[model samples]
Target: MNKEALKKKLFTEIYDTHWLKLYLHLLKMLDDEDDAKDVVQEVFASLWNNFDAISIHTSFTSYLYSSVRNRAINYLAHKKVVISYEKAEELRDVNFSNAPDIFLIEKELAFQINSEIDNLPPKMAAIFKKSRLENKSYREIAEELDIAENTVKKQISRALHLLRQKFIHIKYYLFFL
Candidate 1:
C-alpha cells in the first residue's frame, strides 16, 4: 500500500480501538457531554496530524490516554481564564467610577494591537486574521489560500513577532489568555 493508505489504515484502526474508551473517560472526568466530545475529537485530530513522528515510548494506548488527559487539563485551564476575565469585567462594572489604570491601559493596548495588525503586510495580515479572528487552522487557511502550510505558518509567526515587538508592554495580558 501507499503511504497515505497505510497512514489512513493505522489511524482508522487506532481510532476505532481507543475512541470509545477515551470518550467515556473524558466524559466522566469533564461531566459535560459536549466538552468531552470536543476534547476527544481534538485528541484524535492531533494524533492523526502527528502520527508520522510520534515516538511511543510507551504503548499507543498509554500515549492516547495521556494525550486525552493533557487536552482535558488544557480545556479546564482555558475555562478558568474565561471565568477570571468575566469576573474582572463584573468588578469593573461595579467600580466604574473608580476604574483601575490597568483596565484603561488594556483598552488602549487593544486598539494599538488592532492598528498594528492592520499595518501588517497584506498577505501576513490576511493569514493572521484568518487564524486568530476566524479560528481557522493553518491547514484550512493554506487550502483556502492555495499556499503551502509552511508558508501559512511562517506568515503567522512573522506577524506575531512584529506585533510582539510593537506591544511588548502588554504581551503578558494579551497573549496568554
Candidate 2:
C-alpha cells in the first residue's frame, strides 16, 4: 500500500483505539473539556505531520502518551503564562521527567554500537556479530570458527562489556534504547 493509505490506516486505528483514552487523560489532568479536546487534536495533528518519519520504539499507545505529555506540558506552560503572567521558569517543577525521545536515540546508538563492534578485535567482533546479527548460537559460532563454546561465550561477554562501557551514559534509558 501507498504511504497515503498507510497514513489513513494508522490515523483511523489510533483515533479509534486511543482517542477517548487520550482525551479523558487530558481532561483529568487539565480539567477542561475544551482544552482536553484541543490538546488531543494537537497531538493527532503532530502525529499526522510526522507520520512518515516517526518511529515507534514502544507501543503506539506509549508513543502517543509521550507526545501527549510533552504537548500537554507546553499547553499548560503557555496557559500559566497567559493566566498568571508568570515566567516559564516558575513552572519548572512540573513532572515532565518521564518522556525521553527514545526512537532516534535508539537508532543512533545502534549505529554507533554497530560501528564499534565492527572495530572490535577481529575474532571477538566476528563472534559477537554472528551471535547478534546472524542469530547464531554459541555452539554454532564456535563450530564455524573452530573455537570452544566457553571461548565463544567469553569473547561475546567481553565484547558486550566494552560496548556497555562505551555507551554507559544511556544505561538509564536501556528499556527503550
Candidate 3:
C-alpha cells in the first residue's frame, strides 16, 4: 500500500477499534468529560504527527491509554497549586465561624494523617504519594521509580498496613480520653 493509504488505513482501524474505549478510560481518570475529549484529540494528533515513524508492533490502545494518563496527571498537577490556594482561602473564611471547633478537628485529623504518612519507609512513602496525591497508576509509579509494578503495589500495601496499625493505636488512645 502507498504511504497515504497505509496511514489512512491505520487511522481508520485505530479509531474504529479503540477510540471510544480510550476516551472512556481517560474520562474515568480525569473525571471530566471535556478534558478526556481533549486528551483523545491530542493522542490522535500525536499519532498523526508521528505517523511516519509509527511501528506496527506498537499496541495503539496501550499508547493511547498511557498518553492520556500522562496528560491527565499533568493537568491535575497544574491544578493542585490552584486548588491549594483556594482551599487556604476557604479555610481562612471559615476560621471565625460557629463551627470553628469542627474545623480544628478536621485540621488535626489532616495533620495526623500527614504524620503517619511521613513515618512510612522512604520508597513506600514516595510510591504512596505518587499513587494517592499525584493520582498516578502503579505502572506509572513503577516506571518513574525504576522498579517493578508489583513492587510499587506491594509498597503501597505495606504503607497502608502501617497506617492502619498507627490509626488503631491512635483510636485506642482516644478511647482513654
Q: Which has the greatest lDDT? A: 1
Best by TM-score: 1
Cα-based RMSD of candidate 1:
15.0
TM-score of each: 0.53, 0.46, 0.43
lDDT of 1 by residue, 1-177 (tens): 999999999899989999899999999999999999999999999888888888889987998899999999999999999999999998767666554565776688779888999999999999999999999999999999999999999999999999989877675764442
List pairs with backbone clashes in candidate 3: none
In candidate 2, what are the lDDT values of residues 40-155, reduced to their tens digit?
A: 99999888888888888998789898888888999999998787755444443332234355456668888998899989999999999999999999999999999999999999
TM-score of 2: 0.46
So what's the TM-score on candidate 1? 0.53
Q: In model 1, how large is the Cα lDDT of residue 90?
A: 89
Question: Could you tell me the lDDT of residue 132 within candidate 1?
Answer: 99
lDDT for model 2, on a 0 to 1 scale?
0.86
lDDT of each: 0.91, 0.86, 0.83
Model 3, runs deviating above 4 Å: 55-58, 81-177
Q: lDDT: which is higher, 1 or 2?
A: 1
